[model samples]
Target: MSTATAEPAGRPEGAEDAQGAERAEGAEGTGPIRFGVVGTGWRSEFFARLARGLPDRLELAGVVTRSAERAARVRREWGVPAFLSVAELLAAEPEFVIPSVPWEVTPEVTGELVAAGVPVLAETPPAPDAAGLRALWEQVGASGLVQVAEQYPLMPGHAARIALVREGVIGTPTSVQVSSTHMYHAVSLIRHTLGVGFEPVTVTARAFTAPLADPLSPKGWSDDLTPKDARTTLALLDFGGGRSALYDFTDNQWWNPLRSRRMVIRGSLGEIVDETVVRMADPRTPYETPLVRRRTGLDLNLEGSEVRHITFDGRVVWRNDHTGAHFSEDDLAVVELLCRTGAWARGAAPEPYPLAQGCQDHLIALAVEESARTGEAVATGDEPWSA
Candidate 1:
């Protein structure tokens, strides 16, 4: 293990101060929170972009990779030091460590970091299995350090849509329909928007083995399986407030390619549909209204408009001029939230998307999978799984 100390790089534009004990003592006003990242995969690049965007709030202290070649590559590409061991990386005393490694390695790697009293902003599915997830939660609890990161529900347009629903722009939300093929992704968004520990009254799932092809995968993936290509699941979730949600997952959706992953919500007064563009209903006129489709910048035209015919009310309005990736915007929102709320506050109150929320989403995902396997409705327990 090799340890080296580097001077703090000034805070990135719009960076917020840390909210930890050190900040209360007036340490945050001085510099950015040193952040050491573990893993150099695709997700790392996203975080790197975030770091670049918020240099004031976060500093790239170093990167840790298992292999010398990868470490060298990251150091050269990002212009930051790299370490081969966690201990070596920790020696620099980064206030936060982000683990973007595979789900299988999350339990072990994050467990060690939490035990060392290092806060973590880990990637999704902190563990591959329920047991691993539980163990990670336990370790985080014992360590007295915070572990939190939620990307799905916090995604840019989705978060804004959620706020709109909460504000009653869509009237009383009676039911929600989410169409997605990624089981974990859908569950995370559902759990985040509607609190955790929601029970499903009924669930019907159809599984078909299909070939999978993912160019990003190590095997260069494809979705052509021998038996079936996908599993479609429909779940009826009861939240006890006269609120219910219909969740759908289909492995094969030809139109999916045209739209960046989509989600639609229906309420008594109105409905919101998000695909390439985000469309909403006008609160006062009962007509469809168009919200800003994507993020603020990029190439999307901000002045174009489109109209769609819907069954419920009047024509749905959509805007084609919006530019930017909703996902990237969501990522920036989390960063902005972190800065505004201060970095050190524990749990969801201060963070909005806390470790507990992430854990809850994980549990719900497990229940979804379990319900699919057992062919029975799975009920969520009351335990608040936080770290």
Candidate 2:
């Protein structure tokens, strides 16, 4: 596409300035992790706004747009320096940079940033398709400086579920049913929940269509009763050794609120559905309990609330460091990813999500789509990054 200067006018109110955004929620005195963004698109705003709100943990060193006019707008609106190119942006000495460009051009932008020894945290898919993903990996996967911004596994509820799985709450998790996001994102969640790497897999899928009305959204929905064709695609991922996963997704499921998001993680001893769990509690007794969430700002509680943590019975499972950040689940998860990338870049944490894993997720997702379209089973384990 042409050099589209994605407007920051649509950015959420109060996220314009770090000091003024979320005073109640901004992280305090942990030292800011500096980074810049390489695009002015919707994805770029996420990082910029997050840094604006939580200056203690993140700093928006600068942002790069395609032209001087767009750069001027960025500077006037977000108060962070703006650059006409990646080279100009890096001159500000950001610890790392996040490439929030469109899918088709992400690899090019990423490669340019990498050549300057700038660490990168890339957006989803990393590249457009399997070939692009593989090519990108072959070029930078060995450098240990790039991390994909795949944060589904780190979402509070999802993270809690993963923690429970690792604790053997459901015994050995053999199957996972995820119907949240779509394509590579859903694949990433399934792989993380099932604790599988780039294993050989066989994928089979089918797409179904139906007319349905979407009722709600983050900004509420329309009262129009007109129906739209909702394509529901179901894919099965077989990870050998008695491990498999079912990925179910409906059209617009990512943003439509009428469709309730759900997951069913089944193991040998029991299973977890949403917030409740049914599993063996002891040698002779089977018990059932709910995953309770502690919130500070609802009901009769006058406190302006936020998610404090998630728990099973009384034990805390996932704690929310951004307790009052006023961020959504996805936003909260992304903030964690950014900080994790910062740590890895600074030699303080383990590799977050390697480029190969992101590629594998997309490669199998492509196979699922290919199989669904042709009504055949697609075999894996032949890719260069296959673990």
Across 34-63, the per-residue lDDT of candidate 1 in tens digits comes to 777888888777667666666755667888
lDDT accuracy of residue 349 in candidate 2: 46
Error of 2 at 31 (Å): 2.2
Native-to-model Cα distance after best TM-score fit, residue 67 in candidate 2, in Å: 2.4
Best by lDDT: 2
Model 1: lDDT to the true structure: 0.56
Local distance difference test values of all predictions, in order: 0.56, 0.78
Superposed model 2: Cα runs more than 4 Å off: 1-30, 215-220, 282-284, 300-302
Those runs of model 1 whose alpha carbons end farther than 4 Å from true positions after fitting are 1-23, 53-57, 142-144, 195-204, 208-228, 252-260, 275-285, 294-342, 345-349, 384-387
* Model 2 lDDT-worst window of ten: 1-10
lDDT of 2 by residue, 61-144 (tens): 999998889888888888889998788888898877888888998899888887777778888788998779879988876565
For candidate 2, the lDDT comes to 0.78
Model 2, residue 347: C-alpha shift (Å) = 0.7
The Cα error of candidate 1 at residue 232, in Å, is 3.4
